[model samples]
Every structure is written in structure tokens, then in C-alpha cells.
Target: MSVFAGRYDGRCAIITGGASGLGKLVAARIVAEGGKVVLWDLNPEALAAAKDEVGATRTYALDVSDPAAVAAAAKDSADALGKVDILICSAGITGATVPVQEFPIDSWQRVIDINLNGLFYCNREVVPYLLANGYGRIVNVSSVAGKEGNPNASAYSASKAGVIGFTKSLGKELAGKGVIANALTPATFESPILEQLPQSQVDYMRSKIPMGRLGYVEESAAIIGFMASEECSFTTASTFDTSGGRTTY
Candidate 1:
């Protein structure tokens, strides 16, 4: 049960990467709070499962890195939800952990494509719907790696940094239009995404956290819930830190 009942009543949200991890959890939270959601992910099977698990109103399987796909999904999402009041861009990947000199060119391109370019496409396509309604919330998921620049994870770090910069620009553009945009920078969190990294890399990330521990999905989801709600009326063009003290700024 949600502590803040009806916080998202009558709201409609489109959550990219809604198949798992933070996105899936956030979807469940919004549904529990009386909001409608359309889940988008690259994995069709996972999307189906997530739709059932989160009680999502609709689900779309598409690669967020594809501009055409994102554009189409945005239109379909708006059609499904009637109006998109919230957009949580949570699709991302931790590319191969390797030094810049040794980083695979394809890996780098994939990281930037999905994490940076894909977010841009989603935001570009959805902002019109938000503007039409005169009210909306955008939470773009970034990472503390963007700020601290994690070693051997150059692509992930750089891509996330782009997310931060892009979100700032978008937030400013949408300011005073009743559509708030912000970025979420989370430190090393306990998530399935970590499974992609080596144990050494995970250890390195955990060591950077002053809390001496990884953050839980629920902790970050709680923050996102507020950011996506009507209560987040005044804050825009800002970054919310959930870095377990790894990033103070």
C-alpha cells in the first residue's frame, strides 16, 4: 500500500524500461496510487510480465534507441492513456567495463545511442503531449557515474552525463509551462543492471559510497514518486541526488 494514497489520481504516465528494475518498481507504485501507466521496454517477454506484475494499462516492446520506434511508441502511449502527465525515462545500460583505450567502439555507440539519444527521442516525442495538456512531469534517470566519472566505464559515464545536460536544457525550455523536467542521479544501487558488471567493478562502486552500502530500489522509487506527482510543482531544471552521499552536489 502507498503511504500517499491518491497522490497520482487521474494521472497517466509512460515509463520507458518498465520491464524491470527501477522502472518496474516505479510502475507498481504509480498503479497503487491510482495512476494509469503505459510500460515500454525492449524486451517483449519482460514487458508482458511487467504489465501483469505492475498492473500497467498498456505495454510496448521497442528499442528506445530507434528514433522512429520511440516516436511511434509515444503516439501509441498517448492514445492508450488519453493524456501523458508523466514520463520517466529509465532505459539505460552499463556498457562493457573497460578502459577508454580498450573500449569496444560498438559498445560505446550502443551506450550513447540508448542512454543519451534514446532519451532525447522519447522526450522530444512526448513533450508535445505534455504541452497540449498544460501539465506534466519528466524524470530522466541519470547516474552518479556521470558526475564522478567512473573508471573503466567511460561510455556509461559519458552517456549519463549527456542525460544530465540534456535534462537541464529540456527543463529550462519547459519552465513556466506547467511541465517540469528533472534528472535523477543515483549512485551504485543494488539492481539487476549490476549483473552486467564484473565483481571487481561492483566492488569499486560500492567502495565509493560513504554509506558503505548500495541503495535500494524502493528508496529511489520514493523520490521519483514525488518528482512525478502534483506536489513537485515548483522544482524544474534540477538534479535530485540519490547517491548514498557519493555525490553531494
Candidate 2:
């Protein structure tokens, strides 16, 4: 048996932003560990692709920022897979790289909507199910920018900082309730999200890392997997950093 063998056997999990990047990686790992997964995403094409890869029987197309949609998705997940044992909120946007004063209101709002509000919606919907089952694990994907805001991406920084605060409060509320919440901060990761950004912004991000390279998606997924498993029992309301030595983590 592997080190994580039998760890998530028979457990049910929900992975938002599950269609790509770190979310997709982590979802695959959870399924490989004998757990059931409900993949929630907004992109039909991406969702369909993931469905084909992970099986259509386990995916749902929905926006994480929509509370009613998220609640319904959770119900669908629970009804089909039994109950939610773990949930990973990994959907987010880096938004436009600019000073806050110069940032477009719409752009800044978009980041907050998905990165912070989406997290709130998912947790809001899942908490009841976890409370009912008396067990759950929640992992929110944050960023090193959250710990120390960057110069040109105030929206991304602010949104991620909100995630850190939200996770900590949720963790406190779920204390001793067999439900835990934590955030993961990854800096300059070599993930698909970077594909959407400009070279200059990417260069700026890469320059901040003490390790002198972008972190791998697989490495981030591994840490997320541990936090989702029963092995992460002692940590909650905490920020797990994977910044390649940037921001002191």
C-alpha cells in the first residue's frame, strides 16, 4: 500500500475550478486515492474534456460565485456521492496587472468575485453538509501575493488576502467539529493560469521567487492532497505556503 493508501477510500469530494490547472491535478489525485469526486466548473468545453478524462459521471458545470448554483451543485454532489468529505476551492483570476488607482473597476471586481466571493459561496453551501456528516476538509488556493501584496496586481493581492482571512474564520468556526479550513499560497507556479498572463507580469512574478523558478503544478497538488486527507488533522485556519522561498515561506 502507498503512504496515502486507504486514506480517502470511500470519501466524497468536491473540487471547484476542477476543470484545469491545480484544481484538475488535485481532483485526479483524489480520485486515484479511492475517493469519489464532483468536479464543478463553468467552462463547458473544459468541463466536457475533464468529464471525458475523469468520467462525465463525476462532473458538474457551474459557477462558484453563484450561491444558489453552488448549493444546488453541492446537493447534486451529496445525492450522488453520499456526502462531501473534502472540498478544494481553486477557482481564481489574477486580473489586470496595474496600480489600484489605475485598475478598471470591472477588472478588480471580477477578481474579487471569483477568488474571494466564489470561495465564500462554496464554503457556505458545503458547511451544512459537512456539519451534517460531522466531517470535512476545505482547502482554498491562495497566493504569496496574499501574504505580501505585489506592486502591480492590487486586485489579485486583495482578493487572495480575503481568502486567507475567510479560511481562518471558517477554521475557527469549524474547530472541534471535524471540519477544517486552510489556505494554500503558491508563488510563480508553472501552471496553466500563467498562460493567460503577459510576459512582463510573468517575469515580475518569476523574479520574486527565491528559488529562481516557477513551482510545479504537481508539487502544489501534492501539498493540497495532504491537506485534503486525514493526515492534515492538526492544521486548520492556517496558511500553507509553497512560494519557493518567496515571502518567507
Candidate 3:
């Protein structure tokens, strides 16, 4: 039932955080469109379940924050898939909800490590494979919080902002090489990540969306599907907004 049927024919993708939420949803779309995918996630059990659910070609228990692990997984994925055509970085956390002054230092560091540094490692290791093929798509998930900093979510916002900046730089570097990189800035979405936040925090985010509701996973996945396809050929090094009108700039 995919309008994008056959759009991904013969393509192979590596999706971090492919175990659930947006990552899992995106994997389903790619599979429905005739692409093969290799999933990477921190939870082996979830990874296994996701692979079965989405019919992924492979799964790797990965901690993107670990540079060595990311590197090894990248090579293994390429070896297994023959080539990697797309990378969807959706694995992230909201961290503890608290004012910047009260934010736990450890929590802040953890958010930055996983949300920003981890993404950097994945991109660095995978770009070589993409460059070798001279064709690739990278979609790094950011947040509306990144564009307009949210109170009590400083770490998440800052890390996502870094994602935007990093993706911009990478897109430029890969320009004219047939490889493209972009970032996704979505407003608060109805996701498992919301469970980590207090209800008050979630409500605050929901209130910011002019659409009067949180975004659906499918809605975000649709944009990602397009961004990670040949149709996105000319729009490299840019940020695609999915903020439900919360971010118009």
C-alpha cells in the first residue's frame, strides 16, 4: 500500500535506532518500497524484534556513542549489504527535563554524547562507503527545540542544534560527489521518547505546535523517505522542517 513502491529498488540502508519509534517506522517504509535494511540499536532484544517485524536483512547491537563500535558496524554493514545507500540516524534521547542551572552534568554529557557525538561517528565511518559508491543519502534527525531552544531541555536542544550544524558541513563536503547529507527538524512528536519526559514538559512541547497536536511517526517517516531518496538530489546540506508549524524559518 505504499505510493513509493519500487522507489527503493536495489537500495540498501543502515538505520540506527531501527528498533522502534521513528526509526522502526522508516525501516518499514523502505522495506515496503523494495529496499533492504540493516538495523543498528543498543538493545539486542529490540533489534531482533525489529528485524523480524520489518524483515530487515540484518541487525547489529550497537552503541553509537562508542566510536570503535560504530566503525566496526559500518564496515560490517557494508560487507553484508555490498553497499550502503542510505543512513537514517534516529537513535536519541530527551535526557532529564530540568532547567539549565539544574541539569545534571552527567545527563547533559550523555545527551550530547549520544545525540551529537554519536551521530558524528556514524557519519564519519559511513561516508567512506557512500563515497565509494558515489551515491548516498544521510538524514540526521534534529528537533524544533534545536531551532528555538526549549526551557528545561537545554541538552537536547543544544545537541540537536549541533546535528544541524554538523550535517550542513558534511553536506557541503560531499557536494558534487553524488552523496548528500541533510537534517530533519521535527516538533514534538507522539513517540516513545516522550515517555522519558514529565507530563508537564510534554504538554509544553505540544502547546508550541500550531497544529494543536503532536506529529505522527508516519508523517515524519514520509518526509524521511523522500529525503533519503533520489528525489532529494538537489537539496543537500539543508534542514527539512517537520515541526507542525512550530518552526517556520
Candidate 4:
């Protein structure tokens, strides 16, 4: 651990949804390991709070769903941090819980906009810098729901699945370019986002997990930290599962 402790020493990272949840924990890990971090989140208040909590180098209150905003924020982050070696796209939302037939059209679109399209926007804006430097790591947060397609969560599942596909394509394109892209498919984690789901739906999800427990944000941060480090070489266009035995593939 001592030898690997400073893996990110001098590296800089951009973490979306860093205001809370796994993203924030990732930021803490990077910072703890001597990396500079720029936190991006839609909530200004949460961003401020997270800055204090994680000792982030900078914080941007920007909506990743908007391409223009994403582009601007990307530039700002690069400028502020000097260079961004890692990008963690954890900014997502779990939209309404309703069957496809009864799902609200607005809710479906919103989930797609934030979870999928927003991810694309961030990746598009950041990859350029990585290309110029010829070095980078990208970790997109997906979910087990995407792989298994949870009932009554069509929007969430579909959006996360899109992330998995998009990440694979991006990784292949960057193959041998000193950049690696991958996605993480995690089971239900203890986070504020869980409040959006109905208790019944949450229970159903937990029942499927052989571990009989929700994932901890710290556990996810640890995996993500490794993925963002130079130690994670030779892996790209892959999906790493944090599903507690729920997904064997």
C-alpha cells in the first residue's frame, strides 16, 4: 500500500456527481493519495459542502446534460487543474419508478438526458485533453440494473446500459492511445439517491443480491481509485461489477 499510495501524486481528476455518494468518496480517495480533484455537480450547495468534506481543488456547479455547459466546465476544469488525468462520470439520477406502460414520458426523457446523454457530453468534452496529453483514465458509473434490466426502472436501466455500450466504443477508439475507458456496474449502494426509489422496489433489488446487503460507497471508491490509477493498465472497454455476487459475468 505504501508503494502504491502516491500513484496519483501530481495527477488531477474530474469527478461528476462529486457532491455526494460514491463520486464524493472517490474524490476523497484521490485527494488522500495526493491527487488534485475538481468536483462537478448540479447542486451548488452540495458542491460547496463536498469541497470542504473532500478538500477538492475546485468545484463546478454545472449540468452535464447540457453539452454547452459540459464543454465550458471541461475547459474550466482543465484550466484550473492544469491537466485532468482521470474522469469519473458518476453524475446520474434514478428517475421515477413505474412500469413502462405507465411511465411518465417526461420522466423517461429526463433519465435518458441525465444518465446517458449527459455521460456522452462529459466524455466528449474531456477526451480531447486526454488525446493531447496521450494519457488518461475514464470510469463511467453504470449499474446492475442495466445488466439485468430491473422491472419498473426502464429509464434507469436503459440509460445505464447505454453507458456500458458507449464506454466500450470509446475505449476501443482510444486503444493504445495512452487512454483507457471502462464502466462499473454496481448493485444498490447506500446513497442519498436511494430515497428516490419506493421501499418495495428497493427491497426487491436487495433480495436479488446474494450478499443480502447494500454496497458501501467506500467500497466503490476503492475500486474506482484503482481504475483511475496507472496500476489499472491493460484493461479497457470492460465492465467491472461491484454487485456483490449478483452478477457473475
Candidate 5:
């Protein structure tokens, strides 16, 4: 029940989308465990709010989809924290909920940009610092939709699937080196991100869960905390399911 408490002592983490939702929850957990955290979020207001709420060591207004921005922020964050030990690529958007044909081209591009490409940017920019330190825990947040494509939500599913593939390659590339990479496939959880979806889509997703209920922020954060810790040794380039039994694979 207390997997996260004091689990991250001495570690430093960078959490994208740390201004709200699961990202914020994970930052809070890491801080509670005495870990140092630097938050990267696009929303200035939410970034300020999260800094106050989570007590992160530093906060940067970052747009992860922008490679240059991510690279610069990575340098600034490392300069501020002295080292980058963990990375949680949590910033993303769901885009529009429409079928492939009806999904606006712009919407699809935006989804891919923020969810998949943005994740790439963060990982690429931060890995150097991790490699220099020779120790790191990287957690990329995917979703059940990545495993099982959802109806009328092609962009989200594709972006998340890309995350899984990217994490796998990263894990392999960093294997034998002190850093490890993994992805989280979580089912619908109670968070502000839910507001982005339509009620029908939300209900459909929840219905797929065997537990007949959505997951909780703490539950997601627990798995993430473990993944981001030395305790998660031996697991790399793998997907951890927090899908309430919705993912049997």
C-alpha cells in the first residue's frame, strides 16, 4: 500500500505534463519520497499551480513537441537539478474522437506530434544526461488503446502504440548500460484528461475493464513509482499493465 513512500530518495526526475492529471500525481508521489523533481509543462498557470502543489525542485514551461524547446529545457533542467536520473514522458493530448476517415488531418497530426513525437523529444534530449550519470529510469505512459485499438479513436491508439515501440527500442539500446526504459499501458483513470473525451467514448472504454470501474491516480502513480526506482531493476523495454485486467497479453 505504500510502495511510493520514500521509494525515490536521492533520485531526480523530469515529468512532462506535470502540471496536471497523472503527471502531477506522480510528481507528488516522488516528492513525498524525498526525490527531487523538475516539472515541464506547457501551461504557465498549471505549471505554477503544480510547482506550488507538488513542491518540485524546479519548473519549466516546455512544449515537448518542439525538439528545440525540449533540448533547451533539458539543458536548463539538468543545470538546475545537477543530474537527470528519471524521466516520465507524460505530456499528451487525446485529439478529436472520430473515425479515421472523419478524423481531421490536423487533429491527427497534432495527436501524433504531442503524444508520440513529443515523447521522442523528451527521451532523446534527456538520455544524454542519463547516460553521463550511468543511471536512470524512464517511464513512457502508453494506454490500453495502444494494445487494443479503440473504435473512433485512431489517433490516440496509434500514438500510444508508437510509445510502446519507442520504449522497446530505447530499452534495447540502453541495455547493459545503467539506464532502463519501459512503458505503462493504463486503462481509463480518473483524471482531468478524461474531460477531453466524449461521454460515449468514456463509457465504452470503462466498459472494457473487467473490474467495471476506472483506475485511480494513486494506483497509476504506484506502478510508476516502482518503475522509476532501483527496485524495478531487471525490467526494461517492457509494458506494465495498469488496466484493471483489461489487458491479458
Candidate 6:
């Protein structure tokens, strides 16, 4: 009954932001599929709670935006999990929302550092492990806003768009090397991040989605799971949109 089909047996997966929300769901799914999971998060308490709930999970408490921390975690993960077969760059922040003219420079930089630069850190460090082992799959979580920039969310939108571009470039570079790099774009999903937004903004976002409802974290996780699986062998530098009809690009 498992759609994972034992494709992940004996493999190791690293998911940044795995302490909560979509990342948490993805990590749980990876374990369900017989893969070992190493969760990287900025919050120590959340990581501890997640490990308690998930059981048998390796966790690293570190900020994704810190390249040194990311690199160290990558080395530790390789040593602990035996070379990552899958890497999901899910660490992101929904920064201060305001019109472009009023957007704070610091906030914009914060979002970019984590969503864009942090993603690069993971790819840089993890890919070597994959390349050395001759195989790997990566799914960077982008957003519907990345495809069509949303009003008042310049920072998040821009950072995610960069992630999409980064994924494509990496996928092509390692195309013949057995490493598959792809990005997933999902419409507003039900998550703790939504709880952080003003209700008005939340309703505004939901209305734009053709589905008329926020996506479930588990649904996004399943799609990402497939992309990380060996069965997803044909796609690279591709964007798999889970936009609920909110995407045209």
C-alpha cells in the first residue's frame, strides 16, 4: 500500500527545515519509505520535539543561512547517515510583507540569505557526497509566487524564483553525472507560516488559488517524496507545480 515502493530502502535523506511544517511532513514520509532521515533546523527545541515524535531521526540544530553551519552539518550527515541519497532544501522564512517601496532592506536580505543563499550552501556541500557515490536527487521548494510575483511579498517571491533558477542550473551541470536536481512550486499550503500572516493576507492568498483552499502539507510532501525517489529518474532542472491552477508558467 506504500506508494514509495521500497525505493528508499537503505538510503539517507536530509531535509532542511525538517523541524516543522512541510519539511516535517516530508521527513516523516521519507522514513515511511524506509529511508533514514537527518533533520536540520535552526531551533533546538523544535528539533528535539521532532526527534521525539519521529523516533530514529538524526537532527542538527543550525541556521540554514550560515554556510559554515550548513557545511558542517553536511559532513556530519554523511558520516552519520552514510552519504545522502536525497536532499530537500526546505528552510525558508516568510519575511515582513509590505509594498516594494516600503519593504525593509534588512528583511529582504534576511529572506534572501536563507531561501536563496542557504539553498546554495546545501547544494554545494551535499552534491559532493552524491557525486562521490554516483547518485542523488534534490527537490528545492519554491512557491507559486515565484512563477507570478505576488503583491506585497517581494522578498519571498524573489528568493524562491532564485531557487528555481539555481535548481535548473545545477540539474544541467550534473545531468550526465547521475545527480538529479529539480524544484517544486506549491501554492499557499496549510502551515505554521500561514498562522504567522495576517488573516486578511491569508484570505487574499487563498482566494487567488484556483483550488479555493490552501494546500495540505502532506500533499506537498508526497509530491516532493516522488521527486526524491529513484523512480523519478527522468526529470531534472524541471519545475513541478502544485499550484492549484494558480500557475500558468
Evaluate all candidate structures by whole-model CA lDDT and list the values in order: 0.94, 0.86, 0.94, 0.93, 0.93, 0.88
Counting only residues 3 or more apart in sequence or on different chains, how many pairs clash (N, Cα, C under 3 Å) in candidate 4? 0
User: TM-scores of all models?
Assistant: 0.99, 0.96, 0.98, 0.98, 0.98, 0.97
lDDT of 3 at 128: 93
Off by over 4 Å in 2: 1-3
Error of 3 at 141 (Å): 0.5
Candidate 1's TM-score reads 0.99
Candidate 6 residue-wise lDDT, 1-249, digit = tens: 235646678889899998999888888777877888999998899999998776535899998888898999999988998777889989999888799999999999999999999999999999999999899999999998888888899999999999999999999999989999999999998888886677887888899988799888877888998899888899999999887889857
Q: Give the TM-score of candidate 5.
A: 0.98
Candidate 2 weakest lDDT stretch, 10 residues:
1-10
Q: Cα RMSD (Å) between model 4 and the true structure? A: 1.4
User: What are the per-residue Cα lDDT tens digits for candidate 3 across 132-182?
Assistant: 999999999999888999999999999999999999999999999999999
Q: Which residue pairs in model 5 clash with each other?
A: none
- How do the residues 1-249 of candidate 4 rate in per-residue lDDT, one tens digit apiece? 122578789999999999999999888888888899999999999999999999999999998899999999999999999998999999999998989999999999999999999999999999999888899999999999889999999999999999999999999999999999999999998999999989999999999999999898877788888899998899999999999999868
- Roughly what TM-score does model 2 have, to 2 decimal places? 0.96
Which parts of model 5 have CA positions greater than 4 angstroms off? Answer: 1-5
RMSD of each: 0.8, 1.7, 0.8, 1.4, 1.1, 1.3
Candidate 1 Cα RMSD (Å): 0.8
Error of 5 at 48 (Å): 0.4
Displacement of the residue 165 alpha carbon in candidate 3, Å:
0.4
Per-residue lDDT of model 1, residues 1-249, tens digit only: 345789889999999999999999999999999899999999999999999899999999999999998999999899999999999999999999999999999999999999999999999999999999999999999999988899999999999999999999999999999999999999878888999999999999999999999999888999999999999989999999998899999
